[model samples]
Target: AQSVTQLDSHVSVSEGTPVLLRCNYSSSYSPSLFWYVQHPNKGLQLLLKYTSAATLVKGINGFEAEFKKSETSFHLTKPSAHMSDAAEYFCVVIGFSGTYKYIFGTGTRLKVLA
Candidate 1:
Protein backbone atom coordinates (compact mmCIF):
# COMPACT_ATOMS: atom_id res chain seq x y z
CA ALA A 1 0.00 0.00 0.00
CA GLN A 2 1.11 3.53 -0.74
CA SER A 3 -0.09 7.03 0.04
CA VAL A 4 1.15 10.60 -0.40
CA THR A 5 0.55 13.75 1.58
CA GLN A 6 1.23 17.34 0.59
CA LEU A 7 2.46 19.06 3.75
CA ASP A 8 0.90 22.42 2.99
CA SER A 9 -2.43 23.25 1.47
CA HIS A 10 -1.08 26.60 0.36
CA VAL A 11 2.32 28.23 -0.01
CA SER A 12 3.09 31.89 -0.66
CA VAL A 13 6.40 33.34 -1.79
CA SER A 14 7.75 36.68 -2.92
CA GLU A 15 8.70 37.08 -6.56
CA GLY A 16 12.45 36.73 -6.11
CA THR A 17 12.41 34.32 -3.19
CA PRO A 18 12.81 30.60 -3.08
CA VAL A 19 9.87 28.20 -3.20
CA LEU A 20 9.43 24.94 -1.39
CA LEU A 21 6.55 22.45 -1.47
CA ARG A 22 6.86 19.51 0.86
CA CYS A 23 5.54 16.05 0.21
CA ASN A 24 5.78 12.83 2.21
CA TYR A 25 4.88 9.33 1.18
CA SER A 26 4.37 5.97 2.81
CA SER A 27 4.99 2.96 0.63
CA SER A 28 5.57 -0.70 1.27
CA TYR A 29 8.39 -0.73 -1.28
CA SER A 30 10.54 1.56 -3.32
CA PRO A 31 8.17 3.52 -5.54
CA SER A 32 8.46 5.94 -8.43
CA LEU A 33 7.47 9.43 -7.42
CA PHE A 34 6.32 12.33 -9.58
CA TRP A 35 5.32 15.97 -9.31
CA TYR A 36 2.74 17.54 -11.55
CA VAL A 37 1.51 21.09 -11.88
CA GLN A 38 -1.81 22.42 -13.10
CA HIS A 39 -2.86 25.93 -13.91
CA PRO A 40 -6.29 27.41 -13.30
CA ASN A 41 -7.88 25.43 -16.12
CA LYS A 42 -5.06 23.58 -17.73
CA GLY A 43 -3.96 19.96 -17.79
CA LEU A 44 -1.43 18.45 -15.44
CA GLN A 45 2.15 18.90 -16.54
CA LEU A 46 5.02 16.73 -15.41
CA LEU A 47 7.33 18.78 -13.24
CA LEU A 48 9.83 16.13 -12.23
CA LYS A 49 10.21 12.49 -11.46
CA TYR A 50 12.28 10.26 -9.19
CA THR A 51 13.12 6.76 -10.23
CA SER A 52 15.75 4.40 -8.77
CA ALA A 53 18.44 6.06 -10.86
CA ALA A 54 18.97 9.41 -9.18
CA THR A 55 18.00 10.74 -5.80
CA LEU A 56 18.20 14.32 -7.00
CA VAL A 57 16.11 14.93 -10.12
CA LYS A 58 15.58 18.03 -12.20
CA GLY A 59 12.65 18.80 -14.41
CA ILE A 60 11.12 21.47 -16.63
CA ASN A 61 11.66 25.07 -15.61
CA GLY A 62 13.96 25.59 -12.61
CA PHE A 63 12.25 23.06 -10.38
CA GLU A 64 14.01 20.17 -8.69
CA ALA A 65 13.40 17.55 -6.04
CA GLU A 66 15.43 15.12 -4.01
CA PHE A 67 14.26 11.67 -3.17
CA LYS A 68 15.02 11.04 0.48
CA LYS A 69 14.49 7.40 1.18
CA SER A 70 15.26 7.61 4.84
CA GLU A 71 12.76 10.34 5.50
CA THR A 72 10.30 9.20 2.84
CA SER A 73 10.12 12.70 1.51
CA PHE A 74 10.15 14.26 -1.98
CA HIS A 75 9.98 17.98 -1.57
CA LEU A 76 9.94 20.35 -4.57
CA THR A 77 12.06 23.46 -4.63
CA LYS A 78 13.03 26.33 -6.88
CA PRO A 79 15.59 29.08 -6.55
CA SER A 80 13.10 31.80 -7.42
CA ALA A 81 9.38 32.20 -7.58
CA HIS A 82 7.42 33.46 -10.57
CA MET A 83 3.82 34.53 -11.02
CA SER A 84 3.40 31.79 -13.63
CA ASP A 85 4.33 29.29 -10.97
CA ALA A 86 1.10 29.92 -9.18
CA ALA A 87 -0.96 26.77 -9.53
CA GLU A 88 -1.86 23.46 -7.98
CA TYR A 89 0.89 20.94 -7.41
CA PHE A 90 0.32 17.28 -6.86
CA CYS A 91 2.54 14.54 -5.49
CA VAL A 92 2.08 11.14 -7.05
CA VAL A 93 3.52 7.70 -6.33
CA ILE A 94 3.27 4.35 -8.01
CA GLY A 95 4.48 1.11 -6.48
CA PHE A 96 5.42 -1.87 -8.67
CA SER A 97 3.79 -4.57 -6.65
CA GLY A 98 2.05 -6.59 -9.39
CA THR A 99 -0.24 -3.70 -10.23
CA TYR A 100 0.07 -0.15 -11.52
CA LYS A 101 -1.57 1.70 -8.69
CA TYR A 102 -1.13 5.41 -8.32
CA ILE A 103 -1.57 7.47 -5.18
CA PHE A 104 -2.01 11.22 -5.41
CA GLY A 105 -1.65 13.96 -2.83
CA THR A 106 -4.36 16.44 -2.00
CA GLY A 107 -2.34 19.17 -3.72
CA THR A 108 -0.74 22.45 -2.68
CA ARG A 109 -1.64 25.83 -4.06
CA LEU A 110 1.26 28.17 -4.75
CA LYS A 111 0.65 31.90 -4.53
CA VAL A 112 3.23 34.29 -5.85
CA LEU A 113 3.46 37.77 -4.42
CA ALA A 114 4.64 40.75 -6.35
Candidate 2:
Protein backbone atom coordinates (compact mmCIF):
# COMPACT_ATOMS: atom_id res chain seq x y z
CA ALA A 1 0.00 0.00 0.00
CA GLN A 2 1.01 3.57 -0.69
CA SER A 3 0.21 6.59 1.42
CA VAL A 4 1.13 10.28 1.37
CA THR A 5 1.53 12.61 4.30
CA GLN A 6 1.82 16.37 4.03
CA LEU A 7 3.94 17.57 6.95
CA ASP A 8 2.33 20.94 7.21
CA SER A 9 -1.26 22.06 7.26
CA HIS A 10 -0.35 25.65 6.40
CA VAL A 11 2.67 27.55 5.11
CA SER A 12 3.22 31.28 4.93
CA VAL A 13 5.85 33.07 2.89
CA SER A 14 6.66 36.64 2.12
CA GLU A 15 6.68 37.79 -1.47
CA GLY A 16 10.06 37.22 -3.16
CA THR A 17 11.11 34.65 -0.55
CA PRO A 18 11.59 30.98 -1.01
CA VAL A 19 8.82 28.48 -0.38
CA LEU A 20 9.01 24.92 0.80
CA LEU A 21 6.28 22.35 1.36
CA ARG A 22 7.14 18.95 2.77
CA CYS A 23 5.64 15.61 1.85
CA ASN A 24 6.42 12.03 2.73
CA TYR A 25 5.15 8.73 1.42
CA SER A 26 5.26 5.03 2.09
CA SER A 27 5.01 2.28 -0.50
CA SER A 28 6.14 -1.26 -0.94
CA TYR A 29 7.61 -0.38 -4.33
CA SER A 30 8.69 2.66 -6.22
CA PRO A 31 5.65 4.89 -6.68
CA SER A 32 4.82 7.87 -8.83
CA LEU A 33 4.50 11.11 -6.92
CA PHE A 34 2.98 14.45 -7.89
CA TRP A 35 2.15 17.85 -6.52
CA TYR A 36 -1.06 19.61 -7.47
CA VAL A 37 -2.23 23.08 -6.61
CA GLN A 38 -5.83 24.24 -6.35
CA HIS A 39 -6.99 27.78 -6.16
CA PRO A 40 -10.25 29.07 -4.80
CA ASN A 41 -13.12 27.53 -6.76
CA LYS A 42 -10.66 26.28 -9.37
CA GLY A 43 -9.49 22.92 -10.59
CA LEU A 44 -6.28 21.25 -9.55
CA GLN A 45 -3.16 22.03 -11.59
CA LEU A 46 -0.06 19.92 -11.78
CA LEU A 47 2.90 21.54 -10.08
CA LEU A 48 5.48 18.82 -10.58
CA LYS A 49 5.83 15.06 -10.89
CA TYR A 50 8.40 12.44 -9.99
CA THR A 51 8.56 9.27 -11.98
CA SER A 52 11.45 6.83 -12.22
CA ALA A 53 13.13 8.93 -14.88
CA ALA A 54 14.48 11.91 -12.94
CA THR A 55 15.15 12.51 -9.30
CA LEU A 56 14.76 16.24 -9.68
CA VAL A 57 11.65 17.45 -11.50
CA LYS A 58 10.70 20.95 -12.44
CA GLY A 59 7.28 22.34 -13.19
CA ILE A 60 5.31 25.52 -13.83
CA ASN A 61 5.74 28.73 -11.78
CA GLY A 62 9.38 27.98 -11.03
CA PHE A 63 8.42 25.10 -8.78
CA GLU A 64 10.56 22.01 -8.41
CA ALA A 65 10.78 18.84 -6.33
CA GLU A 66 13.33 16.12 -5.71
CA PHE A 67 12.49 12.48 -5.19
CA LYS A 68 14.46 10.91 -2.37
CA LYS A 69 14.06 7.20 -2.16
CA SER A 70 16.17 6.82 0.95
CA GLU A 71 14.14 9.27 2.96
CA THR A 72 10.87 8.34 1.33
CA SER A 73 10.29 12.01 0.73
CA PHE A 74 9.41 14.26 -2.19
CA HIS A 75 9.46 17.85 -1.11
CA LEU A 76 8.33 20.81 -3.25
CA THR A 77 10.27 24.06 -3.42
CA LYS A 78 10.11 27.39 -5.19
CA PRO A 79 12.89 29.95 -5.46
CA SER A 80 10.50 32.81 -5.02
CA ALA A 81 7.00 33.21 -3.74
CA HIS A 82 4.22 35.10 -5.44
CA MET A 83 0.81 36.20 -4.25
CA SER A 84 -0.79 34.10 -6.90
CA ASP A 85 0.89 31.06 -5.38
CA ALA A 86 -1.55 31.14 -2.51
CA ALA A 87 -3.53 27.95 -2.83
CA GLU A 88 -4.06 24.44 -1.52
CA TYR A 89 -1.41 21.91 -2.47
CA PHE A 90 -1.85 18.17 -2.40
CA CYS A 91 0.67 15.35 -2.45
CA VAL A 92 -0.43 12.34 -4.46
CA VAL A 93 1.13 8.94 -4.80
CA ILE A 94 0.28 6.19 -7.26
CA GLY A 95 1.41 2.64 -6.80
CA PHE A 96 0.96 -0.23 -9.22
CA SER A 97 1.05 -3.59 -7.53
CA GLY A 98 -1.19 -5.95 -9.50
CA THR A 99 -3.73 -3.14 -9.35
CA TYR A 100 -3.30 0.59 -9.47
CA LYS A 101 -4.04 2.65 -6.40
CA TYR A 102 -3.80 6.36 -5.60
CA ILE A 103 -3.24 7.96 -2.21
CA PHE A 104 -3.66 11.67 -1.51
CA GLY A 105 -2.38 13.77 1.35
CA THR A 106 -4.54 15.98 3.51
CA GLY A 107 -3.14 19.05 1.69
CA THR A 108 -1.11 22.10 2.69
CA ARG A 109 -2.49 25.57 2.27
CA LEU A 110 0.00 28.26 1.20
CA LYS A 111 -0.53 31.87 2.05
CA VAL A 112 1.56 34.60 0.48
CA LEU A 113 2.14 37.78 2.41
CA ALA A 114 3.00 41.12 0.95
Candidate 3:
Protein backbone atom coordinates (compact mmCIF):
# COMPACT_ATOMS: atom_id res chain seq x y z
CA ALA A 1 0.00 0.00 0.00
CA GLN A 2 1.07 3.55 -0.57
CA SER A 3 -0.04 7.09 0.17
CA VAL A 4 1.16 10.63 -0.44
CA THR A 5 1.17 13.84 1.53
CA GLN A 6 1.81 17.35 0.27
CA LEU A 7 3.52 19.34 3.00
CA ASP A 8 2.43 22.80 1.94
CA SER A 9 -0.94 24.32 1.25
CA HIS A 10 0.61 27.19 -0.61
CA VAL A 11 3.99 28.25 -1.95
CA SER A 12 4.76 31.67 -3.35
CA VAL A 13 7.81 32.31 -5.47
CA SER A 14 9.13 35.33 -7.22
CA GLU A 15 9.19 35.17 -10.97
CA GLY A 16 12.56 33.88 -12.24
CA THR A 17 13.40 32.36 -8.86
CA PRO A 18 13.44 28.74 -7.86
CA VAL A 19 10.36 26.72 -6.92
CA LEU A 20 10.19 23.87 -4.46
CA LEU A 21 7.18 21.84 -3.40
CA ARG A 22 7.58 19.19 -0.74
CA CYS A 23 5.98 15.77 -0.72
CA ASN A 24 6.27 12.57 1.30
CA TYR A 25 5.02 9.05 0.73
CA SER A 26 4.70 5.63 2.28
CA SER A 27 4.63 2.30 0.49
CA SER A 28 5.20 -1.35 1.14
CA TYR A 29 7.11 -1.84 -2.10
CA SER A 30 8.91 0.26 -4.64
CA PRO A 31 6.26 2.87 -5.44
CA SER A 32 5.62 4.93 -8.49
CA LEU A 33 5.15 8.63 -7.81
CA PHE A 34 3.88 11.40 -10.03
CA TRP A 35 3.39 15.13 -9.98
CA TYR A 36 0.42 16.77 -11.67
CA VAL A 37 -0.49 20.40 -12.12
CA GLN A 38 -3.90 21.94 -12.58
CA HIS A 39 -4.49 25.41 -13.80
CA PRO A 40 -7.69 27.29 -13.13
CA ASN A 41 -10.57 25.91 -15.19
CA LYS A 42 -8.34 23.28 -16.74
CA GLY A 43 -7.74 19.57 -16.38
CA LEU A 44 -4.85 18.13 -14.43
CA GLN A 45 -1.62 17.66 -16.39
CA LEU A 46 1.18 15.26 -15.61
CA LEU A 47 4.40 17.01 -14.71
CA LEU A 48 6.77 14.19 -13.87
CA LYS A 49 6.99 10.64 -12.63
CA TYR A 50 9.46 8.42 -10.79
CA THR A 51 9.29 4.75 -11.62
CA SER A 52 11.82 2.00 -10.94
CA ALA A 53 13.88 2.98 -13.95
CA ALA A 54 15.02 6.42 -12.81
CA THR A 55 16.12 8.34 -9.72
CA LEU A 56 15.91 11.85 -11.13
CA VAL A 57 12.97 12.62 -13.41
CA LYS A 58 12.49 15.63 -15.61
CA GLY A 59 9.17 17.04 -16.69
CA ILE A 60 7.49 19.71 -18.70
CA ASN A 61 7.77 23.43 -18.04
CA GLY A 62 11.15 23.04 -16.40
CA PHE A 63 9.85 21.00 -13.45
CA GLU A 64 11.71 18.00 -12.01
CA ALA A 65 11.65 15.73 -8.96
CA GLU A 66 14.10 13.33 -7.40
CA PHE A 67 13.07 10.15 -5.70
CA LYS A 68 14.75 9.57 -2.36
CA LYS A 69 13.98 6.04 -1.31
CA SER A 70 15.55 6.32 2.13
CA GLU A 71 13.58 9.41 3.03
CA THR A 72 10.39 8.20 1.30
CA SER A 73 10.15 11.61 -0.24
CA PHE A 74 9.70 13.02 -3.75
CA HIS A 75 10.09 16.75 -3.87
CA LEU A 76 9.32 18.88 -6.93
CA THR A 77 11.68 21.63 -8.00
CA LYS A 78 12.22 24.13 -10.80
CA PRO A 79 15.22 26.34 -11.33
CA SER A 80 13.21 29.34 -12.53
CA ALA A 81 9.58 30.16 -11.95
CA HIS A 82 7.34 31.71 -14.52
CA MET A 83 4.12 33.57 -13.85
CA SER A 84 2.32 30.99 -15.96
CA ASP A 85 3.50 28.27 -13.62
CA ALA A 86 1.02 29.42 -11.02
CA ALA A 87 -1.24 26.48 -10.49
CA GLU A 88 -2.32 23.71 -8.11
CA TYR A 89 0.18 20.87 -7.93
CA PHE A 90 -0.63 17.44 -6.57
CA CYS A 91 1.65 14.64 -5.45
CA VAL A 92 0.25 11.29 -6.54
CA VAL A 93 1.09 7.67 -5.82
CA ILE A 94 -0.44 4.39 -6.79
CA GLY A 95 -1.52 2.15 -3.96
CA PHE A 96 -2.08 -1.59 -3.96
CA SER A 97 -5.16 -1.90 -1.78
CA GLY A 98 -6.62 -5.07 -3.22
CA THR A 99 -6.32 -3.38 -6.61
CA TYR A 100 -3.93 -0.77 -7.86
CA LYS A 101 -5.31 2.77 -7.59
CA TYR A 102 -4.20 6.35 -7.52
CA ILE A 103 -3.85 8.32 -4.31
CA PHE A 104 -3.49 12.06 -4.41
CA GLY A 105 -1.97 14.42 -1.89
CA THR A 106 -3.45 17.67 -0.63
CA GLY A 107 -2.53 20.04 -3.39
CA THR A 108 0.03 22.84 -3.09
CA ARG A 109 -1.07 26.11 -4.66
CA LEU A 110 1.77 27.99 -6.28
CA LYS A 111 1.63 31.74 -6.71
CA VAL A 112 4.17 33.62 -8.74
CA LEU A 113 4.98 37.18 -7.75
CA ALA A 114 6.12 39.87 -10.12
- lDDT of candidate 3 over 1-114, digit per residue (tens): 678999999999999999999999999889999999999999999999988878999999899999999999999999999999999999999987688889999999999999
Best prediction by TM-score: 3
Residue-level error in angstroms, candidate 3, position 3: 1.0
User: Can you write out model 2's per-residue Cα lDDT over 5-105, one digit (the tens) per residue?
Assistant: 99999999999999999999998888899999999999999988888989999999999999999999999999999999999999999977698766789
Off by over 4 Å in 2: 96-99
- Sort by TM-score, best first: what order? 3, 1, 2
- Poorest stretch of ten by lDDT in candidate 3: 93-102
Candidate 1 regions with alpha-carbon error over 4 angstroms = 95-98
**Tens digits of per-residue lDDT for model 1 on 6-110?**
999999999989999999999888888999999998999999999888999999989999999999999999999998999999999995568786789999999
Candidate 1, residue 22: lDDT: 100
Least well predicted 10-residue stretch by lDDT in candidate 1: 95-104
Clashes of each: 0, 0, 0
